[model samples]
Target: MAARRRRDNVLVAVLAVLAVLGGGRTILGWFSTPPPGPSDDTTTKIVGRSQLAESFARDFVVTYLSASANQQDKIAEYVSSGQQVTLPSTGRQVSDPAVVFAEREVSNPQLEVWSVTISAKVGKGAGTAVGTSSSAAASTASSSGTTTSASNASATAGPGRQYYRVAVSVAAGRVRALSLPAAVDAPGRGSDLALANQNSCSPDTPFGQVVSGFLTAYLTGSGDLSRYTVPNSGMVAPAPAPFVSVETATVSTDTTGCGTGGGTARVLATVNPKATDGASPTLAYPLTMIFSAGQWQVQRIDPLPPLRNPLTVVVGDATQGPQVQSTPSSVATTSPSSAVQVPPAKQN
Candidate 1:
């Protein structure tokens, strides 16, 4: 028994020593550990959006896509010498050219890449098109064992949005293309999906009235959200609200949040918010509500919408992309285009 007690004492003493060391390191910063979270740039020590890389990448894509054979000289301003970007023979015009994704190279911090998507309204231009080389995506086989290539299939199919990815080197504060831009596919779209909120709620009902009234107060600050929500939620309306008016376009409830929801329910609503500049943008909200004091009361807005998929981690994020999640404890986010595809340089 005495031998066992000695062993136990030794083990406890070792653990106590470790605990003290750990506490000192955490409280006094003794071991010089790195920060618990990301740096001020919200990323790593080597990679960052430091050089206005997004702007340069966006401009490079726009100039490359506007490939008029006669105006190939315009590309020289973006792409480095000795490198050539394939120009579409039929001219392409791009508009609303926005950067959808930006990426940084950890191995090479001086290099940044971005993917810019242009829902360009392509129009036919009579000018000649220039391409360094030609390759066919779709080929036809003739009866004589001969093959033919149709490189202009996409060009003839019609006009629509196109996506491009380009990498830029922000070396010594000079932003230039790291390589030729390559055609990238648009984000994957989901089809035939059902959601809990179908905008079917009538504003005349008590549920609808409460949801409509709460949103109006939240956006316009004309009323108080505390009046519509359960007490102690501390939901505050924005001071000097951004919208002039809020209209409930559609609303619905999930199975648990549907019906009279005498005790508790969830309400999903779509609102048309008119900004001060007369710009009306549609917004969606996923919220929870409670029934108390013989009346319906608003609850905290859920951080995420309810998903109805069989094998899903975040179906709503994939489908109801633009929906906003608001709360003191939660934040809203959207999908980012942060990938790039760098094709090989042409031989000719």
Candidate 2:
């Protein structure tokens, strides 16, 4: 009888232990952490620019624009071996070839399309029109390096200059002209940005002095450049500046008026760069001046000018390309030689 009672007790203990383990497991399930949700970050890729495609298109356009009758061989240098270009009966004078627009083909990953623009000067004689761009020759004149070759369109386009856009395709190191250049409209004009001539003061104003000084030093090599720009702006100009003199056209201010103290101001001005007599480039720049420390100083010389119409400039085409008097190796640099006179900011 004792043996039977012990066997029953053992079975009862085993059942109780199993029940305690099951209950503990159920409680633990309630406290367990839920799985983490999906991540929020989704990486997006950026496309890199291809300078080769742009450069090849630019060179091909210049040659294509200036080609005369039966010059298909010249164009074949840029196009595929079997391709031929319709040559003009008479050659047109074109200069300052610039790439106005560029984009890669999404459908053909290897190909890129570029809109190469050039300034066409008046032709001496009537020329046979083989290409579409020549269609504008009826009204074509000349441009001062007009993109106006100087970054800013000169109010005066000498020799009846007209702007031309050529669509070019580039792939694997070769450029292709699938179509002749088309004469398109000049870029639409934006809002005017002229300085308020509110006060009678012209050259004597403090701000005027600062701007004039900056330009004089930058273009004409007249004053010390260090006096006009902010410290640590890595702007550098080649020695023996590009022009003989500079004159500010219109000085404008942002929120603050030019007469009273203001934070920033833009000059709708033209400081003509009188390039040495090869082809006179249009001398103009879109520049801003800021008031810092006790006086006004030029804000900065952008590596690339703003896409909007550059501030108008009126520099007298007085001087030629100056001999690089000194090499400025210490700072970054850009020489505004084509129809514009934007000097990179000077660094100490």
Candidate 3:
């Protein structure tokens, strides 16, 4: 009888332990859920892409019209990575997410549909984060580059509506190709401002009074800019940066029944203002004008187009095709000795 009792006690203790372990396992199972899914970040390897390039372009256009200088800088980062962007409109690799949010304020402008192509050049250690430090490493490593060309519809709907496309090209994981503003064309011609002005101001309107009225309306943003644009609002020449004095003005003369579309004598407005660029007062800059609807309207002003240099091509291979030394056959060349040939070379 003693032996049997001992055996029973041992069996009971073993059963209890088993019961505890089973219960613990049950509880753990009830509380635990499956492991969380993998994250969305996929770009880990180096590669070239077209879609990523489109995203960069879309972001750039949005940044161009931004009023806040700071917001613009954040958007600039994707293009240039090193510069310390101080102005809201200048910077690189910005961190602010809310900066690009205000693009909803302005309506997307009417944009033409065009093709955009991007080529990718990715070397090992060639990211903006370490570009300055490891530039040589990136340049020396066996570089893999790809060129991706794609066609996308770039449209601006009316004054503020713009559409963009995003594409992706992958080699290993990183984006290495991109294109921008590949093509541009207006779907339709904009309304003619000259025709629209015929229904508005007139030659009888005094030039000074008109200028003053326009200035006041623009500074306050009160008048309808859709009808008339102001240089102060960044719409016209003579950007309203350095304020100048108005020296004199001449009323416009209307010439009716001379030509079709109601021709009018081109008016003239002369003003001698102090130069912000250190030009002399005797310069007497003459602003070309047109008299329409009995008012003198500015047509053109003095200022050359912004300077742009020709692109420099660096040949990568000596085994490539021979360089052509001959000029294009289409170019008509006369004797270089002529006294400064005028543009078009007085065709025939």
Best by TM-score: 1
List candidate 1 stretches off by more than 4 Å: 1-37, 42-51, 67-73, 85-92, 109-119, 124-159, 191-206, 215-226, 230-251, 254-264, 270-283, 291-294, 300-303, 308-348
**Residue 198 in model 2: shift from native, Å?**
9.3
- Cα lDDT tens digits for candidate 2, 134-190: 223322333222132232223333344455565666566566666655666654533
| Highest lDDT model number | 1
RMSD in angstroms between candidate 1 and the native structure over all alpha carbons: 18.7
| Residue 19, model 3, lDDT | 100
Q: Model 2 segments beyond 4 Å from truth?
A: 1-201, 272-285, 302-348
User: What are the lDDT scores of the predictions, listed in order?
Assistant: 0.60, 0.52, 0.31
Backbone clashes in model 1, listed as residue pairs = 89-129, 101-337, 199-251, 257-266
**TM-score for candidate 1, residues paired by index:** 0.51
**Residue 84 C-alpha lDDT in model 3:** 41
